[model samples]
Target: MKTQPATTQIGWLGIVLLLFLAACAAPPNSPTPSPVVPTQAPSPTPSPLPSPTPVARSLRLWVGEDAAALPAIQAVITNFTQASGTPITVIPKPPDALRLSVAGLSLSGEAPPDLIWADQEILAGLLADGYLQPVRASGDALPGLQTAATSQSQLWGIPITAQNQLLLLYNRSRISSPPTSSDDLITSSRAAQGGLVMVWDEPYWLVPWLYGFGGSLTAGADGPPSLNTPAMLAALNLFGELAVAAPAEVKTYRGGQRWFGEGEVGLMVDGEWALSEYRSLTETLDLGIAPLPRIPATNQAALPLISGSFLMFARDLSRDDLKPAEELAHYLEQPTTQIELALALGRLPASMEALADPRLQADPGRAAAANQARQAPGLPPTKAARCALFGIDVWLPSLLKGNLDQAETAEAMQAEAEACVTQ
Candidate 1:
């Protein structure tokens, strides 16, 4: 209510200014205004990133002594690795020693070979023991194989090579005309000045006659324990005649190549692999290859013992591990590889495509060997059957020893075989 002076108003304004300054200098513990955060477009739900691609792996392989075919094998592995982005390693093992080593490994269950190139007889034993895995022919890995080779009914091993013992190798210079029949062969053998050089003591060498005479060492669809037939007796008689006619060294002849290579024998029944060694001896020596002659009475094609097969074996491998093994096996069975092996090793290729290879068609020796293999029949599946007449390992040496008479030996052999079949 009292009238104040201008100076008094000015003082009041100054006091208000001081109070504003004090409020602006408030304590540090006081709450402050927070910054405004912009909302992110809900991170586009990361499309579940696709999983990384699986990397391809490498494969390991075991091989047998086909030294001549090594280049082809290496090329195949290299090409396959390049194409599939995979890798392969091959270990070479001798054929003869392979079976023993594999057996020992399986027995110990330690570091068994991933694959084996084994004799067919040895494969048979291994298959019986469940040491191998059967494979089908139709697959991306080995598209070149014919279904016949991988037929499901008789799956045991993949036949990489087909070797038979019924090939009749003649010195083309000595024998102007090759015989077409067994009787002619017999007559020709007797007429030869140096005498014929068939593998007299080798059981496999005798297989053609066993079949030609309509004798089956193993039982057919009929049943078991029936090998002592009249046909077998006739085969035995013919064998005995040939044995008597052969040279004294025939008893001592360790191998067909030894006798044939020496040129002491005019005609020899042996495997095709012998051609190389024989050729080395005398390139000028005319070499002729022919199938075993048909028997006089029976015109049926004779059965020859098959040699060996390639089998896959991996200890405790999963399906993934088996994939490469199967693929490599298939690659080996391809027409190119098979044909090359046949040409190089003088062995028959398993696949029909290989049989029809142009390279083989161009070679007379290869063609003859292939033809002989196609015409020859396979041996009976049983061990007893093979041991009795096919000249399996045990009976072969005993038969060659010549200690027992034909009758006695046949009886003993038959008894052992029959016992085996019964068991």
Candidate 2:
């Protein structure tokens, strides 16, 4: 039985080998099968390319003599850079030097600042020359800016600070009730020794009188220039009276703050900024602030409001450059930054929100000034208004020297200013 089983296993193995050979063998006549090709992977859809990174460029800004304003400006610039990923360089130049530098830059067609933080009056000249780009009068770009600060139906700059020509800084010890009317101011001036010691020969200061007497630099909608009007003549007469009541040296007195702070003057017409300088004069010397006295008959409060603004000069800038500049300007106009600036630099904030700050409201003087600015009648919306208000370089100093009588001075100035407008 064992021998039979072994022989049977060999026969089974041979049978299996024959079946494998049969399976492996194929007919040569069968059409050669095409070689199987690797199926190409479905081509992947290409991804869109990313936007290019913005180029890094340096921006130079010209600012004025406010050391306190520097930190806030820097903070804004730093924040702008962080948010927009750009670089800004702020150059604080002397106020006197800024115009010359800007002029030089324009003349050479090279190296101009990307922005300028300057007095609006100065920007007026630049605007006339087409050196500035119109800010397009967008809503709230300069939230608290008066119509006077803008130009050509557009905002040329973003006003950040403002001051007025007529501020009544009085000595509290001498007078309990501050004068509310021009007649009252006159009466007080005559009663006091050394009188008011008015800071003589400031035309801007004199503008209040012109307004009080119902005169304006420019004509109303239908009227002619009012320089020679009867109201102007009366204002000049009143000013002459005030000038006579003042000290002989009043002509030489540069500012009334010194005279008022020293207790030599009873009443002074100055700006709110004078409070800081005169605060230490006397603890008992009560300091009172009020808007410039109004004309008795007309009941009009006349003030020459001066404002400063932040301007952009990068008309040729790409989006990358413009984004940061716009951001920085926006940062500077923020409520918090405006408050900080008002507190640190004694500047009035350009935003209405900043005006609501408790710190600014604490000081009745600043609060009053802020209120007056908010309500004050703004200058005309023309570059010529600036030249009319603040005569050209030579004319300003000469007029301040008090060489001509009020009539002659006003006439000469009006003519010069008109010429500047025509030119």
Across 1-423, the per-residue lDDT of candidate 2 in tens digits comes to 436688799999999999999999985786789999999989999999998986778788777655766887677667777876767788887766676767687576857778778765556566665767755322242332546545545677766665543578777777776788878888888775436855555566666777677777667422233455577666766777666557655554454556667677778777665677667767544677877777877777655454545554544545556666676667777777667767766767777667778889898777778766664545654646655655423243454456766577666666777666666
lDDT of 1 by residue, 1-423 (tens): 999999999999999999999899867796678999999777656688899988765555666655666676567668877766667776676766666667787577756666665555556566556666776554222111122122224455566766544577787777777777877777877775435776666667665777678776666522354446677666666777666547665554455456666666667776766666667777545677776676767876554644534555544556877777677667776777676667666666776666777777676666765665654555433455545653332454464457655565566667766676656
| Residue 405 alpha-carbon offset, candidate 2, angstroms | 7.4
Model 2 ranges off by over 4 Å: 1-34, 40-52, 55-59, 83-86, 106-110, 137-145, 220-226, 283-285, 318-320, 377-383, 386-413, 416-423
Error of 2 at 333 (Å): 3.7
Runs off by more than 4 Å, candidate 1: 1-39, 42-52, 66-69, 103-110, 139-154, 192-194, 220-226, 254-263, 379-382, 389-409, 420-423
Candidate 1 has its poorest 10 consecutive residues by lDDT at: 139-148
**lDDT to native, each model:** 0.62, 0.65
lDDT for residue 275 in candidate 2, whole number 0-100: 72
TM-score of each: 0.76, 0.76
Instruction: Name the Cα RMSD for model 2.
Output: 10.0
